[model samples]
Target: MENSKEQVIQLNLNLIVARGPPVPTIPVPVVAAPPTITVPAFRSEKFSVPEQFDGTRSKLLEFTTQLRMKLEVNHDRFRNDAAKVIYSVSHLEESALDQVVPLVNANLAAPFSSITAFVANLEALFGDPDPRGTALHQLVTLKQGKVDFATYYSQFLRIVANLDYNEKAKIDALTEGLSEDLKDAMTYRTDRPDTVEAYATMLMTIDN
Candidate 1:
């Protein structure tokens, strides 16, 4: 019996020795870092200012005075004609004004080279508290270059269209409230002769 017990103990020791200590788990190696991404910088050229209009301030004042005189003399006819033209080329001008003015006014530093830029500036000026500001803004913005002269005429026709006896009265009152220089500046007609002639031709064709 003692020999049997001794044999059993030796069998247990042999089993433990054969099993051996637990093997340590090998850690997984990390891969190389991901590639870095870089973005290119954007560059833009500086804008150049164009030659200023000769006697622009004085001319603008004179124009405004002339416009006021015309408005006063042909008040009824102008209002009626303006209302009629609203739906024609004038509508396009107003639509453009609504788009371009706000953008230009917000960025005064931007160049006013293209019609698009001029329109934007006009839109911004329209929002001014002063009526003269609105008028001058419209005039200056439209006078950017010859490319937009046609557009300016169209817009002018639209403005005329919007004017009625009541609107004229309001404008008159607003003008009265402004400084004389501003009132005069608002009068200048920057519209192209060809455009005006075309507008006249178109007007003649329209039924009363």
Candidate 2:
């Protein structure tokens, strides 16, 4: 029995010796790759108003719209931030900057609160208010003549610029200004456009 127990212990020792020593674990040094940053492709494409704008309120608004659209498209990273927008405006040329800076500076406390108020303030300075109503009445009565359609429409646009008419009123005023034959033809058409600009474009197209 003692011999059998000794044989069992020797067998266990042989098994452990046959299996090599446990592998020594070595800590691996892992290096993290640096993060990649994507820069805007149009980073160098600076934006500014094309020319020194006239003091016309509509023109000023139109210029601002164009500049805003460009910024939104090209500089999307900072487009929604008003501080970035104003910072971009600051870089405009002196002549172009003059057209907008004075107005912006005047309302420094809350510069962009209301577009309507901003435009109205500028309009008061540049746009003549036709309060007496004589000019608008005369303009509405004027009709197409020996003059081409472009000339007639130009006069129509000019007159409407001075008055504060809603879209419907503007369309009605334009329709009234048309010559008798043109007015009849437009009235008969089922597809006549509702907007003044569309109506004018149709007139110009037909006249041409």
- Cα-lDDT of candidate 2: 0.64
Residue 205 shift from truth in candidate 2, angstroms: 4.5
Superposed by TM-score, candidate 2 places the C-alpha of residue 202 at a distance from the truth, in angstroms, of 5.0
- For residue 123, model 2's alpha carbon misses the true position, in angstroms, by 5.8
* Reference-based TM-score of each model: 0.20, 0.44
- State the displacement of the C-alpha of residue 206, model 2, in Å, after optimal TM-score superposition: 2.8
Clash pairs, model 2 backbone = none
The local lDDT score (0 to 100) that residue 120 gets in candidate 2 is 53
The regions of model 2 sitting more than 4 angstroms off are 1-50, 54-61, 68-79, 91-172, 175-202
- List the global CA lDDT of all models: 0.41, 0.64
**Model 1: ten consecutive residues of lowest lDDT:** 83-92
Please write out the lDDT profile of model 1 over residues 24-73, one tens digit for every residue. Answer: 89999999998988875543332232222222332333333343444445
